[model samples]
Target: MPRFTAQELDAHRAKVTQLLDKPSIKVGMSTCGVAAGAVLAFDTLVEEAKSKSANILISRTGCAGMCSMEPLVEVCIPGQPAAMYGNVDAELARRIINEHVLSSQPIVERLVPSIEALAVAYDKSDTPTPPGASGPRQYRIVLRNCGVIDPESIDEYIAREGYQALQKALSGMTSEQIIEELKVSGLRGRGGAGFPTWHKWQLTRDAQGDEHYIICNGDEGDPGAYMDRSVLEGDPHSIIEGMIIGGYVIGARQGVFYIRAEYPLAVQRIEKAIRQARAAGLLGKNILGTEFSFDLEIRLGAGAFVCGEETALIASVEGKRGTPRPRPPFPSVKGLWNMPTMINNVETLANIAPILVRGGKWFGSIGIGKSTGTKVFAVTGKIKNSGLVEIPMGTTLREVVNGICGGIASGRRVKAVQTGGPSGGLIPEQHLDTPVSYEHLQALGSIMGSGGMIVMDDTDSVVELSRFYLGFCVDESCGKCAPCRIGGTQILRTLNRIADLKGTERDIATVRRIAHAMQKASLCGLGQTAPNPILSALRYFEPEFMERIAAAKTARKEPGIARK
Candidate 1:
């Protein structure tokens, strides 16, 4: 294989752009799409294209983030505008081939242009608020490629300016320079904790080790959270390129993707991307004809939520039961078979390529203070436009929940917005204007965890919601420490009693006490923020609990019914 320099890479990218510029039909083949029968649609498209002898390329890409409109298909004819058709099945796929592909007509009812496209369309006109925007403001720094390109094909990724960052970093920038750039970008760890990425890289870079490693944490276990999964499924190459750039910056010789086995499609696409990179001299020795010899491997997690923790992930990669160990000797100091390793989440790594290509300052200016760039949110639950929405940081909760997500479906009053999955907290309607930054969310008793935002309406019970999150923590807790295992279970039981309207005020106090202990004493993040939902709900919706308690008391006072 021939190695390409920076200029050569750009030229190749231009060529790919020209190829994609021509008329074509695109299919969303992400897991959601497949679940909605996208495979049959894809097969039908291929068959129709073959039968008609059309020269269009029938390509498969990752999730477009609008999962509610699954089986999405994008048709871009030479003369007509590109259109996205959602809820596409085999019938629609065939119609798309006949009408959009063969003819110049677009399917008007199914057209859902991307937010970026919408922004461009309304650049001169008044900026119309999107469908839902009740969540916090966010920027899409890490999740730029998700739902934007064909993840399965490297050429498609290349056409969209992928791998250019790797080329730039490897060809022009040194390891120290790359680290400095990341520092300037103020990029923080996206894997729950908001640790500075540069510091982690620098620690591993300075650590005394001949053999170093970089791992992408793709074991996203938060229920209702699928940001990592979407990125892995939609733009596997972006993550791959980010890992390569990370390896180059940290002077690592090897990289590993620690993804959950439950995400079979994500794992499959990532594996395919790795193979393609290797074949293209992007992985393995002397990449791009440079002295940077970085190699990568895939390590599947056996569906253990604890493995999402860095130490536990490293242990799992070493072929052990996924469990967390104490951290003072952090992963940067000793990790992944006792080597100096730097672990970054899939979203964090995906941002690396863009940061390198568009300078660090360029990224830093996109969001609010300290928190730079865009964030991709998996906005689900009680919303009309449910899927992924990427917005700049500091975007208000109201904007995300109401404008982008179209507010609560069917005009129901939004009760709260749940951010950060089981490990996150619920933000009441009163705090809808809160800016979505790591610090802002932390102040509201929440964290900007892998960007999962579940909208809740009036019908949703706060006590029940808290119970659900607490229960998840109890189940996924590794049980390595008592505070997490015991305290989590205790909190769950108390919340359950409250949900069942059988608890006194004392039980609520007990829940708070246990949550505090777990927050303070738990070994890892899973246990630390396990009580976030409970505490946040208690803070904002104490009336809801009091109402339930009052109802229980009223029942007890009336007749022969006994209250537990």
Candidate 2:
């Protein structure tokens, strides 16, 4: 209820830090955690603590990049590192409270290791890489506060140095200085395009427009990707801080959050954070008693994957059908009702505050080449440790699959990993060790996508996977352009025919031709990249297609009574 001032931030942070030193139990209560009975766990902990008269603070926070471990329960005692337990239920929560919170002993058998604790073999190498981004306690950088702090608690977020970047930017730095910091940080857009963030801000700032707009694209409809949703649910304050900084840098009075309607919890948490921010003197007119004034609103997407594209997203935000328009006058030049607009991905915006807080050079030094800063991945499908994994940009696919995800869950030989989403290509097993970057993944016929890595094993068929991804794209196609609309359908048809065991080499050529046409002539990114999955399949597993065609040929040979 009390408004915050820049002068009072440090003293409040120190007080909160002291409060965290007491005994506490924190539950991972994001959507994944909730589905896995996190609410039951939290309830059990509260009931037990009350029954036992235990002096421990029971709270709920966001996923710690470990969705598989939910409902995760963490117990912290003064001067001791928090111990995390996974797959918790009412019984487990009670046990955690009794053994860990009341007494000092952890339930050793029920404990789950941090992401940094695993070092599974990658590509049969003696030395396997770790998803190294943080210290012994938790994941660092963009996801720094994610499993550690309660999303709805503004004080906890501030205690963890949230919004410090905005205060720093507002008090000390100019718009050009902030852009220069981004340039030094080498931060590129993480919305799958790899465009430089600083350049986008610069262009939007320089564009001649009476009004400038900022947008966060949270419409991550990728099948296995939930990076944006998690951040919005877990650490909404950080993003609010990031957006305010972005608005200040680009001289925008307003910002928009275009999130998918499927993410109810994310929507709830972000809305709460926006209100908290406004009440805390961070939003609306004259924030921090400075000239900068910015406010935000939420726009729900109808689960359309194509809206992830900038122009299509703009159209959707304007209450029209979600579709892409031509790109001659890019969004930076003219967008959102012909005003200069800067749309940043959720993950991209999450990085802004961190880059400003910890010097830009420090962030740029972490990842390799132009791919600076860490990326958050929604690791899923056929993997032992399926969850969220945030690692440096240059980390190998093999490392992500084996080292972080603990490789194939079925004990089958690791076959391939699908990066990007429905619009990304597949990386065959042979190239697993290749570094994961925009350029490196592209070289291996895959892409970094929005950071959805689906690990596939030997039992998984490339034809089937390709069919699945292409089918998703086809279903979600805006149908605005003939090439994407027709070509995607034709390619899906051929893949279906092949799966039905009634196709030949000629059919494969037809598929290739159609996919190429879709790529070259599709209206937006959805159409342009719809062929990625099939094209990558053909590039890596054409022999599988041949095998299927050979089976059809054999079936027709002398065994059949009639040939067609």
Candidate 3:
């Protein structure tokens, strides 16, 4: 591997910038896109381009966050703007090559209407009427390069000022300076807990150990969340760059990416990024002609939801069962291999490079209050424009649900907005104006979990939602402790009884009782937070549970069923 000076990196970035200048066909090949048959669309584009002898570049990019409109294809014609089309199949891919690629006509039916204004300058044939000409503008810090550049291309990443942060950190800034920058940024963990990132780094830096390590927690198992996966797939180099900066800041020479095996594309891209970084001398010994050296390795999790917790993640990386232990000696104090460690989630790490590139104060000034910076949400379920949308922290639920996501689908009235996945709680529609800060959501009985915001309309049942989420938690419990394992199952059983027309007030009481025990006595976060959905549902929709109980009483008095 050749060691690169800053000048050489700049020279390389200059060369990579020209790749996007030519007419190119960039396909979104993230997991969502792949699931929607993007592989076929990509292949058809390549074959058709070759057959037509077209002077166009065929490449793959990551998800544009619009999972609902998968198999997304973006066309960049020479001397024109780049237009994105959705729901692209192989046949549509052929049309994209023949009609849009060879000719100037864009297939209006497949075009994602909201972004047309940003990409419609090239089509001088006719003024095409956009479906919905406007939408809430998204602030893209973590997701700036997503769906724009090829994830597997290191040069493309460098072209976008990617490794410029690493060069700055390694060549000029001291470790303490970097930590102070993060402190100034006011960045909190996006992995539900909302812990201050800089404080964690400072603790690990101050902690004495024989050797230090850093871990990137990519085991994002939140049901509706794919923010980390998309970032890893869309902009792998950003995460790599962030990890490298973190390693340097904490004085750790080695880092580990604890990603789930289910995310094959993310794992593949991260591995490729690591290999490329190592080869380019951005990783390994004495990075960027400095004495500081850091390396990264990938560790796959077996799809355990609990492993998203730091202690459980550390345990999983150490070849042990993915269950957490007590945490007085936190991971920062004693982590993997019994050394001081620093762990950051994928989104938190993604923010690192940007914060360094454009000073921390600039990042801090974006969002309101203590929650500074934008949050990348995997907006899914019942929303008209469901995809990945990154908004500033102080943004309200009304802005996200109504203004940005284009309101509820089918004109149905929204019942509640579920954030934080199973670990988090529900926000009733009445509180739509609540700003999406960590403190606000926590006050509403939900945590700002790893960016999974599942919207629910009137058709969704509160009891049913609780049951489904509880069932998931019960199934994913590591079973190392009794509170989570036994309490989770018992709560599920009680919820089932309520759903089955056989519940009583006593059953609901039992749920609260057991939930209290789990919350207070659970070993890990899984146990501690597993009852969140159940408790929050009980808190917000108690009438629904009571209605079931009242109906059951009425039925018992009328039928052959005996009253106990």
Model 1 has how many clashing residue pairs? 35
lDDT of 3 by residue, 297-391 (tens): 99999988999988999999999998898997999999999999999999999999888888888778767688988888988889998988887
Per-residue CA lDDT of candidate 1, range 1-564, in tens?
345656777787888887667776778887888999888988999998899887788878777777888887877666666688888877888788887777767677777765345332111222223336332233344555555567877877888778888888877788899999999988888876889999999999888777889999998888888888988998899899989988887788899998889999998998998988887778988888888899889989888888888898999999998888998798888987788999999888888888887788777866789887667788999998898877777878898889767888789999889998888888889999998899999899888988889998999888888887887788888888999999998888877777776778798899889889988999998899888888888899999998888877776787466533
Kindly provide the TM-score of model 1 when superposed on the true structure, using C-alpha atoms.
Answer: 0.93
Which regions of candidate 2 deviate over 4 angstroms? 115-139, 558-564
TM-score of each: 0.93, 0.95, 0.94
Candidate 2 lDDT by residue in tens digits, 1-564: 556677776667788877656677888989999998998889988999999998889888998777777888877666775578999988988888788777777899999984335322111221223446443311357777787788999988988777889889989899999999999999988888899999999999999999999999999888888888889999999888888999999999999999999999999999999999998889988887788889999999997889999999999999999899999699999899989999999999999997887778877876778888777889999999898877777887787788767888888888888888888988888888887788898888778889898888888888888888888999999999899898989989988888777887799999989988888888899999999998998998999988888887777675662254
Q: Please give me the total number of clashing residue pairs in predicted model 2.
A: 1
TM-score winner between candidates 2 and 3: 2
Minimal lDDT window, size 10, model 2: 119-128
Relative to the true structure, candidate 2 has a C-alpha RMSD (angstroms) of 3.8
- Whichever of 1 and 3 has more lDDT, that candidate is 3
TM-score of candidate 3 relative to the true fold: 0.94
Whole-model Cα lDDT of every candidate shown, in order: 0.82, 0.84, 0.87
lDDT of 2: 0.84
lDDT of 2 at 298: 98
Question: What is the Cα-based lDDT of residue 36 in candidate 2?
Answer: 87
